[model samples]
Target: MSFDQYHEPVNELSDETRTFARMIVSLTEEAEAINWYEQRISVEKDKQAKAIMQNAQHEEFKHFGMDLEFLLRKKTVWRETLKAILFQNGDIVELGKEGEEASE
Candidate 1:
């Protein structure tokens, strides 16, 4: 679906809604990490780990989408969420530093 589909009406959200949105985003981040670990487990020959990871991935995927919707409901930008994710991990900052060092 388009990003616009996630747009939440401004008046519909209260402070609690904003707090829930932030929580969902946090959960999404954790799910992403779990999903990554599951992928790594899938690479191994352990059938049990693979199955567990597969289930976790599916749940996390759903949670991520729902959380995105929650943020949109709060009139928050998807790009802002993305930026928050990246900035929280220092990815953007590290990339910027790498770019500057490479140009020198």
Candidate 2:
């Protein structure tokens, strides 16, 4: 079986690179779970079920955040760009453009 997460041969990658790839995959899965829970909660008729889904979705959010933080710590450029883009009250596109420019 092949893992799509790897673009190159697995044996050629360092242990740290493999772990990063795994964390990236995990982050993607958590985001997908959050999306699924959002849809389920939206249509759920039972309040208790919806509440449970919300709780689960919150966990996904935390997982996503931690995964992102881990990746950011490993990537200075990415962390720098996001530092400019996140938690700022400006035009998002403009901020992104600026972030990209500033990184360069």
Candidate 3:
């Protein structure tokens, strides 16, 4: 209901840009859900409740990954940068710097 995600006028933006913004919001919401579930699971007294929260968290994680993949598919430089940094065994900061350079 809230159109708070857009910094520009909605009428001025293309459909693709609007969809991209919506997905960005979705990604953020999924991340927040994951975090909330993590916090709940950490302090939950009931094992069953914790298990349910964990399951829900897993779903959120999947959504987050999917949303990220969608956005990455839309941006070539972002995809290239992440490829340089992700799944690599090295200093993260260094890898990030390398990724930035590689993308350029």
Candidate whose TM-score is highest: 3
lDDT of 1 by residue, 1-104 (tens): 22222358746668686576566657668677676967687586888877787777777777776766566566445444454444355578676555445444
Query: Candidate 2's residue-wise lDDT over 1-104, tens digit each?
Result: 57999999999999999999999999999999999999999999999999999999999999999999999999899999998899999999999999998888
Model 1 lDDT, full chain set? 0.63
Q: Clashing residue pairs in candidate 3, if any?
A: none
Q: For residue 33, give model 2's deviation from the true position in Å.
A: 0.4
- Give the CA lDDT, 0 to 100, for residue 2 in model 2: 74
Q: Candidate 1, TM-score vs. the true structure?
A: 0.45
lDDT of 3 at 23: 98
Model 3, residue 15: distance off in Å is 0.8
Ranking by TM-score: 3, 2, 1
Per-model tally of clashing residue pairs = 2, 0, 0
Error of 1 at 32 (Å): 2.9
> Can you give the lDDT of residue 82 in candidate 3?
96
